[model samples]
Structure formats: structure tokens, C-alpha cells
Target: MTKMTFRKLLAATALTGITATAVVAEEVDYGKFDGYTLRVKLIGGAQYEPLYARIAEWEAMTGATVDVLSRKNHFELDREIKQDIAAGTLDWCVGSNHTSFAPQYGSIYIDLNGVIADATLAEFQSLALENSTVDGRLVQLPRHSDISNLYYIKSLFEDADNQAKFEAEYGYALTPPETWDQVKDQAMFFADAPTFYGTQFVGKDEAITGRFYELLIANGGALFDDDWNPTFNSAAGVEAVNFFKDLYEAQAVPAGSLNYLWDDTGLGFASGTVALNLDWAGWASFFNDPENSKIAGDIGLVRAPKGSAGIRTGWSGSHSFSITETCDNQAAAASFVTFLTSHESQMVEATAGLLPTRAAVWDDAKAQFTADGNNFLVEVFETYAVSMSEDAFTPPLITPWIEVSNEIWPQLQAAILGEKTPQEALDEAADAARIVMEDAGYL
Candidate 1:
């Protein structure tokens, strides 16, 4: 038999630590569970691993062992969980979940409402809690929320020669973009391509699809009608698609952007090869660190730009934990999840630049940053807080979202690469999305 130790388990699972005293001091007593091993599958990445470190503290407190069953990225973990469902091998008690992926799991996860203390549930942002609930059941406890904002190289905008040339060409002073039209004009004005491009985007998979979806919404288009039929092939949709097409045609963004993911876009901006990037709050720390970014101290940010309809693009979601229905120790699993999302644990994550789900953590984290004299993160948290409360919105809570996204993004790529026209690509994607809705019984 393989023996498990806390270090071995954490390294194998790529998990991180949390603030044990803070959570334990506030929660229902975690009674002793000597020798009980709670198994879990978690999403793994550098930004996410720090919170996992606190599991050892939980083990020490409750005398329960945490056996991490698997550690993979969200996309890979989604596939693994689906396979586990089909195979009926959901032996793990807790799994990482997302708002966009939760509906597809149906009743696999236990309803967390009664399991978690009411006060604890009330502590989370109401919108975060609402998004974590599906079919009137709280299936998951949110860890952190996400929304995109613009990041740019401050030096470029401050360059006097570039500023004069930009104002002359676009009839506006050079500054951080305030609208999608300005983004386009500035991207064209700043771009040199190959060596350096004005901007880039997540080009394929759900990344690009999510980008298009939010832009479509901001452009006053809806993805579907009230009955769930696809309606995103409208004039507004055309305008959204045209935005990408124009950027690509002008070569203002990277040539390989269609193949890029979050890491690619994040690293591209850090490399100082891209002047502007639209990304989530998760990358805020990494983007400003001198060790990781070429333009470290020179970075600037603003809320995501507005579309023709005058609304800001604010595609959003949250990372969360769910207890599986098949678990033998539902109570223990619930306790573990609650402990992880507690105020102190959330502060640990928020300190590392992750956006916390708890409302108070926002104030506390901002205060901590301010006290530390970290003005960059201070502005970051403030900007994101406003967006989270007022501007953020999630994709339609449906099981077929990923499948539909998978079908739509490739068509977007073809159009951006000039292999098809914008209208043709959206028409094809709408047809595919129709089939997905039909099979999901929404037709």
C-alpha cells in the first residue's frame, strides 16, 4: 500500500496553503475524524496551488487525511470528471468546479445550502452565491470570481512622438482606450507586428468564444431567444465579428492569436511584445512582477472598453468546490470546502492577486495592499471590485455551453484568418449552436 504524507500529497496534487487560524477561529467546530482519508480532484496551476497548502492545517486540526486523487487544468479536469460520471467512478468526495461547467454535472454534487452554515453562505457576494447555485440547489461553494480588464504598456502612451502621431491619425489624444473603436484605432496606430504587436487575444477554444460572446452582448445582441433558439447572427453579431476581422486584417494583433490561450496572452503581454491585453484578475500579480514581466513597473490598466451599444464587455465566472453525491463522508467534504472558502483563507488567495468571493475579503485585501504601499494592486482590486459588483455577467447557465463554444470558436478563427467572411462564419456557428440546443432539448 502507498503511504501518504502531507507534503507528498500536496506535491502530487499541486495544492497550496491557506490561513488555518482565521477559518478555524470562525467556523463550526471540526470534530476529530482520526484516520479518515478524504479524497479529492482539484484544478492545478501556480496561481491556485497556494490555497491547497492549508489542507495540512485542516488535517492537523481535524485529524483527517486529505488524499488528492488528481490534479489537472480545468479543461482536462472537466473531461476527467465527465468520464468519471459515465464510468460511475466518482469515488472522490470533492472536486473543483466552475459556473460555466456546473450545470452539466446535473445532480452529481450534493446541495450545499443546508450543509454549510447560513452565516457563512451569507458572507459571500450574493451574485457569486447565485451563480454557484443550479436548479435552486447550492451545488458548489465559490472560491474566487473572475472578470477581464485592459492592461497596457504605460510607456507607449506617454511617448510624445507616438502621442502626437496617434492624435493626428485618429483625431483623439493617445491614452488608454475607452471604447472598442479606440482600441481598434490605437491597435493599428501602435502595431509594428512580428517583433511587436499593439494587442492580442485568446484565439481558439472557449477563450475566443467567451470574448465574442461578451462583445456581442455589449454590442446589444443576445445569444438566443426566450425559447433558446440561436439569434446571434443579427446585425449586432455582425458588428462584433467584424471587430475581430478588422483587427486580424490590419495585423494589429499577433498572427498566432487564434492558437493562444490565457497563458499565451498573459505571457505575451509580460514579454513586452504586446502593447495591450484583456485578461482576468488572476494574472494581475504575475503581470506586474519584475521577475516575470519585461514591462513590470510600466504597466497600466483600465476597465474593459465599451462596445457600440455603450455597455462594457464583462464576461465573468468563478472557481468553486463541489461535494459529490457518491461520497461516503458528505459532512467532512462540506466542512473541508467551507474551511477553504472562509474569510481568512480567501484573504490568503486575495493577497496573491486572486479576486475573492467573500465581500469583506475585498475590503480587507484592498486595505492590506494599501497598507503595504502596493498601489498597482490597490488600483487593480478597486477596478475589479466595481466591475464584479455592477458590470459582470456570466454565460447562460446551460449544459451545452462548452460544446457550443467548441463549435463556434473555430468558425471565428476561420473568419479572422480570412478563410471566410465574418457573416459566413457567424452563420455557420449559429447553425452548429442550433444543433447543440436541439440535442440538449432547448429547441
Candidate 2:
């Protein structure tokens, strides 16, 4: 299907509401704010927009109007927020936030500790709430949490002819890859290039840098030492960089991968050309929908694979809502955020395949899927829950994380595209990361 039609279908599928009784049994008492306008700046995207449609419910319940002042992608929104800080234009009461992006805003957002009820806070997963904290302050209410797992074409492993050829060449039985080494071997084995690639990766900006960071962790290396000194130029780091370089050198991944991002990788997998893709739970419904994917019935999933150090690569973050400290209506803002993250709202998102931050929603959504006979999504939730609970880790919650990412990814592209050896590239990246750490007063 065309991207436009696919998005429309997703919007329709996502906006289907559950019963009001299923949402909240005890009504929220948001006093009265008849003439008040609760201004918000939310992330606008196909997956995120449907949830905004429910803002009307919040307005109606509390006699307040929600004025969405700005709607942009995260990067654009981040820039706008920076400008807002610099110009003293944070007039909007609430804004979209991420765990990685929250620390940079300093004291602009309110500490949501006592604003949201203890019961509500207790309902969310502890790990997600912990990630949302900055300087011991709970600054954002997590909307959803994300970490990736591998998706591949099941037929590639099950095909007798392909299996026989793979076994003959590699001297091992072909199955879903359990390690990055096996992933590489399988990718190379399945590759045909141009017409079909073995795999693809997010290749620029924080996307590539985040991918590298997770791999570095999985290989027993880290971005910084206890002193906050850059330390990712180690042997483990070299192994991590070479993984991407080797794939590019063999033409196992696409030539245009350096220009690709998450959407590119998702659509590539859905097109049935890529042999393997590591992506978030958000794409599970899309990847298995016959209307949107050529590989709909043939797809297979496995938990994210391990690296040389035997740790699973689970770089995670949460999309969240934060109430600004400057807001005149903290109660109304809290009400809106609470409603958006309610069990019903989360169920709406979960039905469309977005992972939930609320623990109860996990079982409720899975049971709903099972009852509906959506075995694909059933497996998707079960697999992702383990990763979200035990395997997931976030980058150090520091302001310069994005700045460090900016310096690292361009050099990463240069290395992957053959302009530098993996060691040389990582050394350069380490030096640049040191400069960032120093500038942030962490040195």
C-alpha cells in the first residue's frame, strides 16, 4: 500500500476507543477551569497523532480547552524548545519529552512528584519512571517505552533449498540468529544486493550514535569512565565499529544506508527485501499487516541478539509529557497528562502496537490481542516485555548526550563508508566526545 493510505489506515485503527467505564471508574475531580486554555506542544507523527484526538475528552471532562500550540518531530521540537528557553517563550503549559532529551531543559519543567497521585505513579513500570527522573526529580510522565528486537523472513530460514545452501557453505544449520556474529553470517549468506540486501541500519545523527552506543555496551565497552572521560576507543569498541564496516564492505547492507534512518529501515523490512531488521515494538502491527507489508505472513521475530560480551543490545527511551514549571494551571496540565497516560489511552496505543509504560496495560492489552486472535501481536508483546523489564538500559542521563552523539555519528559514517579504519574512526570519535564532556564540565 502507499504510505499515505497506510498512515490513514493506522490512524483509523488507532483511534477506535474502548468503553469509558473501562478507562477510569472513579471520576477525576479537576475542579473548574471554564475559560482556561491548556496550551501544549506535542510530537506530531502518524503513530503519535491518534492519541491527540483524545484530547477532546480531557477538555470536555474538565471544562478547559486544549490549545496545541506546536506540533513537530522530536528534533525540530527540541530546537524550538531550546529557542523557547533562550527567548523566555515557554508560555505553553505542557510539552512532549523523551528520557534522553529531558535533562537538557534544566529546571524548566515541574517536578511531578506530588502532582500525580501515588496510585497513578505506582501503576507505571518502575524502570520507566526511573528513566524519567532527572536530578532526583520526576520531570516527565512516560507515554511509551521502546527497545528493539530482530525481525526476519521466516521462509529464509525454513526454505529447504536455502537451508541446504547455507549449511553447505557455513557448516552450520540456519536458524534465527542468536548473536551478532550469527546475524552477520546469515545476512551475508542471504544477501543479493541492490535487488535485495542482507540488512540495513540507521546511519546518521543520534540514530547511528545510539546504535553504536548499544553495541559498544553489548561488547563490554562504555562511552565514559567513572570520571566521565571518553573511553569508547577500546578493543570492544573496535569490534562494534567493524560490524557495521564489514557489512558495508561486503555490500551486504544498502549503499544508501548512510542516508537512512529508522523509517527507512522499517519500510525496507516491510517491502520484503531486507533479510533482517532490528526495530521497536511500534512497528509490529505495520510489519504484519497484509495491507502494508509484502512479507506479512512470512515474518519471524527473535529477542534482540547478544554481542561478544554476551549482553543483549537494548538501548531504551520513553516518549513522555512534561508540565512546565511556568504553567498557570498545574492542576489542569496534570489532569491532561494523567488522562493521556490512562489505562484506556494506553490500550488505544497498545492496540495499534505501541509498547506501554503502565504495567497493567501490558497484561490487559495482551489479553485483548489473544481474544482477538492476533497471534502476531501476542508474540510481539510477550517478547518485548522481557526486554523492557530486564534487558533494557539507557544512555547516561546527561545534557551533553545528544551533543556527543552529533560528533560521533558523522565520523561513524566516514568509517562505515571506507574513509577510515574502524580504530582510527573510534579514536577520532572518542576525542570529539571528550571535548563534549569537557564543555559540559564533566571532565
Candidate 3:
């Protein structure tokens, strides 16, 4: 196995929560744009909305105004941004960007390589900055990173009767799974129809595509060969696809899983019916909140399991902010993005369980969680901080990515639902993806 990769600073501070502040306070010129009403578009959702409350602070600091043109979820926002790009009406100055979605925007956003100060960029994890770059230009400043780990019900694993039954039946101890196959066995074992389920997954759209991509890599498959030819129809790919198909066919996941997305899966786990959920850290607080979660005090987490190749299934990205290339006030826009992703702003977001892109905040936030005796969150940070740095990787950074994804995900859903065999489905999707790449001049 490969040596575990992680940010040295984070690994050194693990569990102990020894506070060592890495972000140096620096005075930044929040350039004066007193009368400027900077129009912006953003991704809207519950976990993301809390950070907007801090926007007023930036407005006050800069003596400028923000005119939010729209606040829709990412899919809607993506369509609008594409329309804006095509219509040459990028009137908005700033917008939300993600590592997976940014490549599709091409040159619509300004390159921040020369705009953001080097010292400020230095504070962020280098991998995040690298992921934000497209064609060697810094297109976005990362706000928070995303990666999944397994979340399970502690009580289920601790029941003596259940343990004995699982051991006798599966020839192994009943515990949090260490591999995808084991997850399947355990999920099938714990399933109890409409009352409870073993686990759930985001079943449709790019969400499922991303899930499949990571598992494909885990099972020793690649989406594309070095020459950009679609190669996800390999045996490894079949294994990955079958994992999901098996769970759905066995009724281990929810019945409506085919239509579910992040919210559905997160809420399903919190409802206490789902025993295992592979999810991002952003939902940690919500999953543990007494008022919101039925399993509030009974959650357990483990690093995402390995596939046949001994690699964890880690499909990762970041939510970020970017300035438009056509902005009327680039300086003001730059200052605003910097302020939004600043150390203090990140601290606020991280405290509520979002994984920080800033390396230093990992230590600072874990320290605070430790001081509060929140061992759960402390362990969460430790596990995710390593995953973010070591295992996290973005989709193929190319302009036709989203277009390619639109073709692949539906085919994936069809295969999972038994509309086609995994091989047949992947072969059809690869043929379509090949045309996409060829039309984009990649092949």
C-alpha cells in the first residue's frame, strides 16, 4: 500500500489538538469602491447560507454594496452561468465555483494568479490551489473542500446478539466496514425493509457519476486512458458499477434512491433508518444535532473503505468564489473574494463542520473542538483533514467535463436499475463520451 499522504502540520496535531496557528495576520487593502453595487450569483443551500451572513461584514469593511443577482442551488446556477457565458452577458462580478464545475466555465472568470497576494494563497492547502487552477491560471479561490467518509450507527455494531449473528453468518465480526464488499455484506445483513436500511447513495445526476468514478479508481479502473480514450468499460469498472447495482437490487438502500441527491441521502441517514452513509464532513454537525437527527448520539465514522486495488474511494472537490473577467471593478471583486475566504471567515464555517481549505484552520478548529470536549468533531477533522490532502482528487480538468458527465450519469443509472448490463451500459457511455471528446478536439 502507498504511504499515507497528508498535510504534515495536520498529521502532527492529530487528536492532541495542540493549537499552532499557521495563518499570519496581514493587513489587506480592501480597495475603496464606495458606490459600487457588485452584482453576484451564488450557490444556495442550508450549509452554505450561514457564510453569507458574514457578507455584511465585508460590505461594511469595504464601504461597498453587494447586489445578489441570484442565489440558486448549483445545478440551476450552472445553467444560468452557461447561458450568461453564451449570451456574452456576464454582468455579474462574482459567482460560486467548484473544482468539478469550474473547468466548464472556460475563461469567463478572471485569473487570480496575479490578483490574490502570494502570502494569502500560501495559507491555503497547495492541493486546493492546484485544483483551482485551469490551463495554468488561478480561476478560483477555494472556500471549503469536500470528501466522504463512512458514517454508521454505533449501537448496531455494539449489540451482542447482532454481533453473534453477523459473525456466524458472514464469518467476520460485525463492525464498521473496511472495504466496499464488506459494506455490501453488512448492509444486506442489517436491512429491515421500510423500517430500516443498511445504507444509501446519491443515485442520479453527476452525484452518482462522481460516486462511480471514485469506486472505479478504487477497483483499478480509469475513466480515460492517457490518450483521452474512454476506458471505463474495463472489468474494474464493471465491479464498481455492480457494487451499486447489487445494493439497489437487494433493497439495501432506500427505494427512492434513484431520485435522491445529497440532501435526500444526508436526511435519510439522520432519520435513523440508514445504518451506513458515506458522506462529506459538512453534515457532521447536523447528523449529531439532537434537534435535527434521531441518531444524534449514536453515530460512528470510519475513513472511506478500500476497493480491490487497496485505494480509498475519494472523489473530492471544493466550493469556491471567483471574479468575472468582465467585471467593472476587478480590485473590489478580488478584495471581496479574499475576504470571503479569509482565515476568520473559514474559522466560522469550519466550526459548523465544513472542511477548511486553509491548512492552518484544520489545527485551529480541531483545537477548539478539543477544548469543548467535542471528541466526535475532533476525530472528524482528523480523518477528513488527511483524506482532503492525501486522497482527494478532482475529475478530469477539461472544458467538456460537464457535457461528458451528462452522457455518463444517465447510462450509469440505467445500468444500476438493470436496464442494461454493466458492460453494455459502460460500452454505450464510452462510445458517447468518445464523440464528446472528439468534438472537443481531444481525440
Write down the lDDT of every candidate, Cα atoms only.
0.87, 0.88, 0.88
TM-score for each predicted model, relative to the true structure: 0.93, 0.93, 0.94
Ranked candidates, highest TM-score first: 3, 2, 1
**TM-score of predicted structure 2:** 0.93
Best by TM-score: 3
The number of the candidate with the highest lDDT is 3
Query: Across residues 331-429, which tens digit of lDDT does each residue of candidate 2 receive?
Result: 989988998998888888999899998877887899999999999999999899877865687888898989998888998998888899888988998
**For model 1, where is the 10-residue window of minimal lDDT?**
12-21
Looking at model 2, residue 432 earns an lDDT score of 90
Q: lDDT of model 1 at residue 355?
A: 94
lDDT by residue for model 1 (75-103), tens: 89999999999999999899999999999
Clashing residue pairs, backbone N/CA/C < 3 A, model 3: none
C-alpha RMSD for every candidate: 8.2, 7.2, 2.8
User: What ranking emerges by lDDT with the best candidate at the front?
Assistant: 3, 2, 1
The reply for model 1, stretches above 4 Å from the true place, is 1-27
RMSD of model 1, in Å? 8.2
- Compared with the true structure, model 1 gives a TM-score of 0.93
Clash totals in order: 10, 0, 0
Candidate 1, pairs of clashing residues: 16-49, 16-50, 16-51, 16-52, 16-53, 17-50, 17-53, 17-54, 18-54, 203-258
